[model samples]
Target: MRRILVTGARGQLGSQLLRCAEDKGLQAAGVGSAELDITDRDAVDRWVEPDAVVINCAAYTAVDGAESDEAAARAVNEIGARNLAAACSRAGAGLIQVSTDYVFAGDRAGDAAVPYEADDPTGPRSVYGRTKLAGERAVHAELPSAQIVRTAWVYTGTAGGSSGAGADFVATMLRLERERDTVRVVDDQMGAPTYSVDLAAGLLELACTGGRGVTTLHATNAGSATRFDLARAVFAEVGADPERVQPCSSAEFAKPAPRPAYSVLSPRSWEAAGLTPLRPWWEALADALARLG
Candidate 1:
């Protein structure tokens, strides 16, 4: 069995990947930024092994913060990815780079808001998005055969979710359901609410099977929803009244970095690559809540 080496091991996806790999009895190891700074080319070279398939989950994912810290974001998202790709190239190892749906402009509406295909033209509008797109380009440039998997709205049902915020959207909704009589959520933005555990499983399968003909693919829970829909679902799942959640517009809570209005990634490319399609977003959310309790 090929060894699995996960970067950003302490992260939601990385940690879940590690657990899944161990459960499957795969030879796997993980390294966080503290253990292996991917931005340091020499350190990455020293850390990467020839027989391992490296899953790069390390990233500067502070979307709002990236507006001011573009250099830091680029260091991790672009240069750091380049370093990993170069090391993998030299070591004759496989690389799977994690990406985001923020790479697209995502301004389409109504009938035009179809899911984004892997080969669609990119139009990133935020520093985080731009830097991540650069990382994708860098990875492809350094290692043409490396696989890039893009996902969106990823969350762990755990206490502290992946967003680096105090609590993730789901956790926050749970809190709000308890503290307030009503809650407001943005309904204009749409994307799949991907469960980190599900994504990790798919990635592990990809790591084990090696690349198909395609280099880039999209992975997320099957269905798409707006934040309002998701928050209401969370409330309903926890036996709270879904009607307590109200729909609002993005203008109500503006952030430094712009969020994609439509981020639903198409699974056509992923399924065409012979990978199993992820379950529906609602199903995944139910399972996530069950696991949380």
Candidate 2:
């Protein structure tokens, strides 16, 4: 039985991975920032053991916040990644580093929207994106055998039934539906919504199906949607009037960091590795909403 250690155990994806790992009877242990700080090289070195597989879910995911605090973001997303990669290499263990689709500049013409591939050229526009890209480069430099999985629009439905800033879009929409007469969402930004539970399963599959080599793969629920679409779906699911959910431009909801006009990540790499792709976004959304109920 291979031992597994998950960092960022309290995060959306990390928490789901820990839960599924235990439910499926896999040999796994999880630690949050409190127990193990990847930014601390000596601590990571002390925590890692030989023959273990480290699933690194720890990351600084504040997109807008990173605009003002690039240094802090880099500490966790880049330097921290370097520490983890170096430690994993020394321990002679396998590593799976979770990454984000923000690595892409996502400024393509709306009509030219395309799913990003694992080996595609990257040009991150935001500090958060740049730092995460640095993390990927760091992992590759130190531990070329590490698996880097990039995902986007991730929501665990833990944050008041939505996903975003620890609260997901679903949760936010559900809350808004009850509080307001109408919900305004951005329709221009396009991407796939990934349920943490599904992503956790995919990571496990990647770990177990070991023909290991350093690989970059994209994983997310199939299909694409805009925030407007997602919000409308949420309204429909909750028996509210979908018409109350209206579409707006990104400028209407401008933030500190720029979001990719398109964040759809290609699933080709995941499928090429002989792993199963997650179900359609709408289908997964239905299941997730059911669970939240």
Candidate 3:
């Protein structure tokens, strides 16, 4: 049996990975941020042992906040990735890194949402994306065998009894639904809402392939969703009127971090790995709501 070291054990994906490890009979340990400061190279060097695969899930996930804290985000996302890769290389272990879909520029001029491929041009619109892309590069630099899996709009079934619907897409929707009677969500951006649990299962297969060099894989759910569509879905799950959710544009919800108007990652790598396609976002959302109930 191979030992697996999972960084950011308490994070969304890390938690899912932990559950999968138990279900799939894999030997794995997910460590929290308190135990492993991924930004510290020497600390990482001390922590990593020989012959253990490293899957880095630790990252600065504050998308809007990263705009003002690029330095800190890069330190953790880019520099820390390099640190992990170096440690893994020294120990002769493989590395699996998690990335994001924010790396795209969100050009949706055509009717079809651009299917971002592994070789597509990376035009990041936010600090978070830039740092994540740098981290992907860093992993390849130190350990050519590193695998990067990029996912987007990750959510779980049970967020401590809270509704997953609109939980992420429309934080304001949930607030307004509770406080007022109506709310508006941006309808411009489109992205796949990835179920962390499903994505985690796929990662294990990719890493165990033991393939050489860095491979960027997009492992999101099958369908894409607009913020408006996602909000309405949440309201439906809660037995609230969908009409209460209104449609708006990015201009109305101007945030510091520029959201990609279209950030849809394909599942070709998942197919290549012979893993079944992830369930539809709506299906996952329903399961998530059931878990909440």
Candidate 4:
């Protein structure tokens, strides 16, 4: 059995990856930041094994915080990724660098909302986006064979989720439904609401193949929805009135980091690569809510 090594094992995706690996009876080891800091090239070198497939889920994912902490974000998003790629290159190991959809500027062409292709031109608008893009480039530069999987709007809908600060979007909605009479969610932004469990399964399947297919691909639950749509869906799932979730524009809820207005990734590349297509976002949301109950 090929050894599976997961960095950022405490995170939602990494934890799900570990669970999926165990369910499939794959040989897997997980390491959180305390166990192995990816930014330290020497430490990363000592951690990676030549016969293992390293799934790098470690990242500085504080979007708004990145606006003021570029150096910190860059250290993990770019330098850390470079370290892992270099280590993998030296060890002759396989790597799967997890990335975000922020690489795209999120602007649709006129009124048309086209899903972003894997090879689409990138134009990151915020510090977080730019740093993640840098990480992607670094990994490609160091290990051309490494797979870069870009996903969007990922959530587990579980209490005390990976955010560490508080509940994730879905989980938050679930809470607000019980605590508040109504909620307002931004409707302008659009992207796939991917469940972490589903994405982990897809990634594990890719790992089993040893990253032989496409080098870059987008893996998200099929179909797209705005934040408002997702919020309403969550409300409905829990027997709450979906109408209680009202729609608003992004301007109402300003943030430090600029979110992509339309960052839905196309499934063309993923499907073409012979990978199993993820279920639709609505379907995934239903399953996620069920798990929470």
Candidate 5:
């Protein structure tokens, strides 16, 4: 049996990954941050045993907050990653880490023009981005057979559950449409909003294909979406008023973290890995919203 150990098991992607592994007949156990403190190098040492593929899903996701708390962010994103890499190395297990698009600086031109490839020059604008990039670098350097999967705008199966990610954009929009007469979302920023369920399934599929080691790959929904368009889709999916969600520029609500204006990562890696494309955002959104209700 392929025993898979998923960290951040309580997280959005981690939760979905556990479920996917179960479906594929893999013995998967997810230990959340509460169960294992990855930043504590000894904790990681004790947690990882001699067998099983390790997937690191836990991350400090606050983009703006990371700007102010750089040290804490590094401790988690960078140091934590290395700890896991070292543990995986010692255990002789494959490492699968989930990363983000923030590693890229937002200076790329046009909305849908720049599709960040795996080998692109990483110019992270935010502290969170830099730390995550550092973590990726550390993982690759330490654990040779680790697979780093970078994704964006993830929505999980439990996105509407008591957990955090479930209460994210889709749930928020659904709530806003019900209570508020109108909701304004940023239109300038663009990304390939991925579904965590889809991403999790895809990750396992990639791993099951018989490859091991550290290779960077991107996985997300097929199409690009502005935050406004995503909000609109959510409203529509839940049978809410699409007009209630209005389009606004990111400049209107400036955030501390400089969000990438456009981060439409290419799905070329999926094809390269001989895996099928992930589900489109529109289709996944409808399924997710319907499941929510």
Candidate 6:
């Protein structure tokens, strides 16, 4: 049996991983930033035991905030990753680094583009993206055998989830549904919504199976959707008027960081590795909503 250690334990993904670990029969330990800051090399060294499977869920995910706080982002996303890689290498432990779709330059550029494959060239357009890309490079440099799984637009049904209340698009829309008459969401940017519960299962599968032939993978729920599409789905799921969720362009809702217009990542490499792809985004969303209640 593989001994598992999950960093970012308080986060949505981490919490879900903990909840699912028992079912998967994984010998697991989870720690949050307060318990084990990944940026601290000594702490990481102490935490990463020999022959352990380390799942790094810790990251600086504030896309807009990262623009003004690149140093803070780099500390957690890049340096933290480097520290984990180094510790894992020294201890002979396997590292699974959780990443995001932001690593790609999501510009649609006129015509429709294919979803990004695991080996596709990365060109991040935001500070958060650049730092995460740097983290990926740092991990690969330190441990070539490390597994990287990039996901997008994650939500959770678990109350007091690590990502925070209303942090995800689904939760935000639900809140707005109760507070406002209408919610205007961006329709330009596109990607899949991945529920943390579902994502946690996939991560565990990789760790338990040694992540064979899956050096780097895109592990989001199947299907593509925009913010508007997601907001409407949230409303529909809650028995609210879907029309209350209106579509708007990205320019109308300006932010500090630029998001990729098309960030739908492909799971070809994951499938090629003989692993089952995650369920459809909409199906997972419904399950998540049911669990939330």
The 10-residue segment with the lowest total lDDT in model 5: 157-166
Kindly report which residue pairs in candidate 1 clash with one another: none
What is the alpha-carbon lDDT of model 1 when measured against the actual structure? 0.93
**CA shift at 4, candidate 4, in angstroms?**
0.7
> What digit string (tens of lDDT, one per residue) describes model 6 on residues 1-293?
87999998888888779889988777999999999999999988989999999999999988999999999999999999999999999999999999999999987555657789999889999999999999999999999999889999888743345556336667777778999999899999899999988899999998988767468999999999988999899999989999998999999989999988999999897887777799999999999898778
Tens digit of lDDT per residue, candidate 5, span 56-162? 99899878899899998998899999999998898877788889999998667745367888878889888999999999999989986788888998875343543
Superposition TM-score, candidate 6 onto the true structure: 0.96
Worst 10 residues of 6 by lDDT: 157-166
Ranking by lDDT: 1, 4, 6, 2, 5, 3
Clash totals for all candidate models: 0, 9, 0, 0, 6, 3
Once fitted onto the true fold, the runs of candidate 2 whose alpha carbons sit more than 4 angstroms away are: 160-165, 211-214
Top-scoring candidate (lDDT): 1
lDDT of 1 by residue, 184-267 (tens): 999999999999889998999899887475799999999999999999999999999999999999999999999999989999
**Superposed model 1: Cα runs more than 4 Å off:** 162-166
Q: Note the Cα lDDT for every prediction shown.
A: 0.93, 0.88, 0.80, 0.92, 0.82, 0.89
Q: Per-residue lDDT of 1-293 in model 2, one digit per residue for the tens?
A: 67889998877778788888988899999899989889999999998989888899999987899999999999999999999999999999888999998999897765677888899999999999999999999998999989899999887665632212357777788879989998889999989998888999989888877524539999999999988998898899878999999999999999999999988999988888888889999998889889978
Q: Which stretches of candidate 3 lie above 4 Å from their native place?
A: 157-167, 170-176, 209-214
Kindly report which residue stretches of model 5 are placed more than 4 angstroms away from their true locations once superposed. 157-166, 211-214
Clashing pairs in 4: none
Q: Considering lDDT, which of the candidate structures 5 and 6 is the better prediction for this target?
A: 6
